[model samples]
Target: MKKISEKIVRLRIVVIVLVFLITIGLGYFIPRLKVNPDVMSYLPKDDAVAMQFEDVGKRFGGNQTVIVGVKSDDIFTEKTLSLIRDITDSLRVTDGIRSVVSLTNIIDIREVDSVLTVSNLIDEYEIPSEPKDLDSIRQYTMSKDLYNGFIVSADSKMTMIAAKIEQEITETIDTNLTGKALMVYYADKYPGKMYEFEQDADTMKIKINKAAVADQIRDKLRTDFPDAELYFGGLSFMVQDIGDIIMHDIMLLGPIAFLFILMALYLGFRNFRGVFLPVLTVLIAIIWTLGLMAILGYEITLVSNVTPIILLAVGSAYTIHVVNRIGMEERNGGNYKENIVAALKYIIIPVFLAAVTTMIGFLSFIYGSYLTMIRDFGIFTAIGVVFSLILSLSFAPAVISYFPPKKRTKTEDKPEKGIIAAMLMFFYRLSVFRGKWVILAWIILAGVMTFGGFKLERRVDLLD
Candidate 1:
């Protein structure tokens, strides 16, 4: 520890340049990172249900299903029928679809001119656009005993298309269709998810923002069918939606947390280096963790996405401790090199132990957790903790060696006794006078928490 601290002071320029280069290198990989939002992807491979589901998806098409609902004022109109025909055709050629069943292609057994005939309910290639033809087709579809709740609903309000195989048609909406309603189902097997990502021009990877594909279909529908409302559901769509939400959090929450931390550090330390150094430590740690994840072929999971904010909250403390020790050495009139070396030797061992213990706490999730993402969260967070310590020991002290703060006036060094300081002083005196009672109060609180833990119930949702 002594030798390392001496080198950090002796070669401060080299350390600063190396750290800058590394930070820039890691930052380059941040844009290429991806998010995985599927819940099933989090399940452990040893999970029996997941294994069975994977086998089934391989044998059939896929276990997951997509349901698209379309609503309009009237389902039997010439315009409405044409829209359904278009949607069915679009699904037929889409990747991962196994089959498609709609009014245009479903087989029908009907009495035509006093003789029974089996044929398609409507000509697949020719959808009726004329009013009389639309009316005639609706009547025929509604009159059949099998078509009432199968092809057309009991009431002619909603229409649905089924794709990728002839899936069971059951009573989806029990209520009679008063408003416009359309339903469609398409099931795909594993690895053939319905919302499979579209390739970029340069073949860059992307996450669940299936907007590339879904947007194309949605934009056309909105322009061509202004009167209809479209709704999407199913595993693939859920994953896509979750991906969007996680991206929003990653983009918005991390910066907000950083600003809050900056404000708090400024309030406490009242110096630029005090605030900047700690923030730099945590930020560089986060960048290193995320970049390492990308380089090692690990996609960000919903669980792993929280690492940045967690490291931001937890990792700053290591650097703060180093800065505090250096401040103490500075106030004693030590030179910059002497101050940094003395402070590092005094604080390095304790900070390293603190980081290791905290890392072990996070790593416990890896040894026992059933969710793969939970394990990933543990691994990356532990790595982030180590990175924070390394930065605190190396980058933080090296930077401090060159830019030791000016000795403050007596009043500035001793912060004013504001409301917060008043409260803190009160607590300090109370602790000194009534130390045993304070300890007893803490024990009582711990006992209450233990009792409460006994009454807690677990709620697990593996499917989510």
Candidate 2:
């Protein structure tokens, strides 16, 4: 410990410069980090539910379906019917669309000369202008069990156009027993093997960017019908909305939290170095942690989204403790080297012990959690805590040694008598006068909260 303190004081400038350069290099990767809002993507690939989901997609084609709802006072009007037909035609010709189901595309079953025949309810370029034609079309649609409640609503005022997506397929042979069994099962179920997984020239092998596709559809609808009302619903839209909200909170709340911490530190220390050093330590830790995440091929998800805030809240405490100790030693008539060495010697073991315990607490999540998001959160937060401890012990003292605090006079060392002091005194008096009752009340409250927490239900609704 003494040798480390001597080395830090001797090589303070070199350490500061190295840390600055490394921080800048890591900051470059911050913009490259990707945000993934897909909750299912966070599940481990070997998880049963995730494997089943992939199997279903492979056997039945892409599971993603987009629903376009068209609203109007009456859907039977000639103009509304024409609009529907136009939208259906446009969607049918759009890329990435496997099939479109709507009134314009669905077939009508009929008996022609004692022979069953199927024909489109609305032929291409055939607009229903007459009331009789519209009525006939309505009667046919409402009577059919397939399209009655699936495509058209019960209110007769809203209709839906469902587009099934055929995602681009990537071929890979699986050697696992489960994969082999699934392949055999699927082959046996479909005798002719009509659904062969093949790469299509027009389809993407990777997951389709549903949000981008939804935006394109929305733009087209808005351009074609300026006054029409439309609502988009799908898994992709929900994921996109979640990503937007996460980004908004990070941008708005992150800086607000930093400002609040800054205010608190400045008011407490009344010294610029004391306020700046702790904030700088936490900032660098966050940058390094997030950069490491990007390099490890991890995307930011809902659970890991709060990592920066967590590091900021937890990492600053180590530096604050060390800085306060050094400040107190200098005020009591210690020289720069003596003050720093004494601070490091006294707090080094306790700080290391605290960091280790905190890291162990976070690492517990890795074993307790089934979700990949929570596991990644644990891993990254533990790394941040380590970085915080290292910076507090090495970089913090090195910087402080170079810019030693000025000796405080007797007047400056006096206790504060401000509103903060008054509040502290009041709390102290209460604790001394009513210590037993206060302890009893806290125990009861904690037990009630713990029991209530255990009864809480888990909800995974992304849209809400």
Candidate 3:
């Protein structure tokens, strides 16, 4: 051990350089990291929600939809009606929409020349170029019993131009659509292109929106037609907003947390090296782990985001404990070689136990029903735990030795007290109790907890 320290001291610069080179080399070979955007990926395949979503997606062809409602004070007025027509017309031409339903596309059964003629008011068979012709069509559109307020507002406050978006339509709307009514009109004309529709004389139903698709369309619409009152509803829209929120939080929270960790280290150790050295070690291990995941093609999901921070917090503890021991040893008159040995010997067993137990706590979660993300967390964190242990054992000792303090006369030992103290206090209190009484108390507590366990109720799925 003495010879090893002397040789390392002689090659201090080489060891430090090698550590940096190794970190950089490993990082380069590891691939860029990516995250799986779908939060559902972490859910178990056999889970009810997973099964339902899969079934709906396959059978009904995407239960997602994008609803566009146009509101005005008096939508039944000629001007507002014209606006509805214009909007519906624009939507009909929009790419990727499966179906569109508005007052414009509804059919009416009317007595024409004393005979009932069933035809769409806005039929492609006849093109009305003038207001008079449009008004004639409107008269028929209004008289029909089927043209209920479902397609229009009762008090004429608003009307809807809805689109059922296909999964492929998400790709198309992202690539091709333009105009405020692109979704509406697109669904109207190409209703059969990607998905089916349901009509209840007045109400229009189309396939749901896909998140990526809905968001692109929403952002473009919001930007280009800032004044347009757009009402977007559907599963796709919901997922799109969630994705945006995740990104926003990542941007806002990640850096602030890093700064907080740095501050914590600085407060604990009052020195530049004390604060940075340990942080650097954890960062290296995390980068290597994530890089390996990227190279191995594992997609990070929502749960994976928490692992890096957990690694940073827990991994730093081992380093700090070692550095604190080294600092204490230098203050108490011990040489670098002896202090390094003392710190490693003292911390190794305790830190190993802590790291192992913490890892077990994470690993136990693998027994959960839906554990894809948790599984990744367990594996990566276990790897980090190993790296932290290694660095604490080797690199930390080497670094501290390179900057060792002058030797002193006496080396005093610090006793481990917290847990031992609590145990002793508990034993002292229990000294008054008879052995039979203690056993009886334990039996009673166990019985009470067992009774409570049976009272636990299973949760219900509202959608189910």
The lDDT of each candidate is: 0.76, 0.80, 0.65
RMSD of candidate 1 to the true fold? 10.3
Q: Model 3 clash tally? A: 14
Angstrom error at residue 45, model 3? 4.4
lDDT of 3 at 116: 96
Please list all clashing residue pairs in model 2, or write none if there are none: none
Better of 1 and 2 by lDDT: 2
Q: How many backbone clashes does candidate 2 have?
A: 0
* Model 2 stretches with alpha carbons more than 4 Å out: 108-116, 171-205
Q: What does candidate 3's lDDT look like per residue over 212-275, in tens digits? A: 5566556655665566566766555665665566666555666676788899888666677678
lDDT per residue as tens, model 1, 1-464: 89878988888888889988998898888877878787776777878988887677657755555555566677777677777777777777654455667777788887889999999888857877788988898887888877788656777887666653211122233243222321112111213222332233423221222322343344545666566766665555666677788889889999999999999889877788899999999999999999988888788877888899999999999999999889988888857789889999899899999999999999999887888889989999999999999999989998887786687688876767887688888999989999999999999999999999999987865345
Which parts of model 1 have CA positions greater than 4 angstroms off? 103-156, 162-226, 413-415, 451-464
Can you write out model 2's per-residue Cα lDDT over 1-464, one digit (the tens) per residue?
Answer: 87777787778888889888888888888888988777766778998888888788667766777788888888878887788888887778765566788777777788899999999877747877899988887888788877777788766788998886665445343434244575565456433311343223433133455555565666777788778787878876677778887898788878988998898898778789889999999999999999888878788887788889888888998999999988877876758888888878888988999999999999999996878889999999999999999899889998888786666677876788887778989989889998998899999999999999999999867657
Worst 10 residues of 3 by lDDT: 168-177
Please tell me which predicted candidate would have the highest lDDT against the true structure.
2
